[model samples]
Target: MSAAADPAAATGPRALAHPGREEIRIEDVLHALADPVRLRIVRRLSGAGEGQACSRFDLPVSKSTSTHHFRVLRESGVIHQIYRGTAKVSCLRQEDLDALFPGLLDSVLRAADHQARRLGEDGHVQRTDG
Candidate 1:
């Protein structure tokens, strides 16, 4: 049978390039998250329990710009992407990130939340009290 017809060749999604966990760098990760758009993407992915399809985000930019943001995130190892059928699903590399930079992700998210609340952008301030 041809490769296309082979059962083994029919994996869930075609492989996409990503930096290995050990290959991730702090500077790259920070840079990737520096952009407002990318930061928003990361924030949304953090709350997405089962990850999210690329199309789900309603970014203000054009499609090409959106693609660029995702690419930066993927390359910097801030997020992981996999092809699910024709769509690319993305999720934060929380485990890897926490391992590499303890408390970093949480701190960033908390700061973002604080700023969001302070600016009244989302009008939702996460409570820190136990």
Candidate 2:
């Protein structure tokens, strides 16, 4: 059926495309998490219990650049995004990821935390609780 003709699609905000869990490849996920900006986004989302609005992040990059990062994360199956009213909300696909590649997310998050402390960036330590 046409998306417009579907009841859920008619009432809900426009849907964003995401790879099915089975289609999520490890290479794409690793590549997406490789970028510092994208890794930061993932780390932030991991700590947030609920989906966070895109604007809630205070990334040190141009708005367009931030948008590109989010798009990469979404396309890589690292996170899921949905439009809510005028805002877009994002959250990690933790369960799917954990099931697909056990301990992968946790390992990456730990590494990020280590690097953050090692670099002494702001001297502020953040927890990677997911």
Per-prediction TM-score to the true structure, in the order listed: 0.83, 0.83
Question: Candidate 2 — which pairs collide?
Answer: none
The lDDT of each candidate is: 0.83, 0.85
Predicted structure 1: clash tally: 0
Q: Residue 110's C-alpha lDDT in candidate 2? A: 96
Per-residue accuracy of model 2 over 1-130 as CA lDDT, tens digit each: 3221234532454887777778889999999999999999999999998789999999999999999999999888898887778898898888888888999999999999888886678755555564
RMSD of 2: 6.5
**What is the C-alpha lDDT profile of model 1 across 4-121, one tens digit per residue?**
2235533554866778778989999999988989999999999987669999999999999999999999889998887777888888888889888999989999998779876677
Best by lDDT: 2
lDDT of 1 at 65: 100
- Number of colliding residue pairs in each model: 0, 0
Best by TM-score: 2
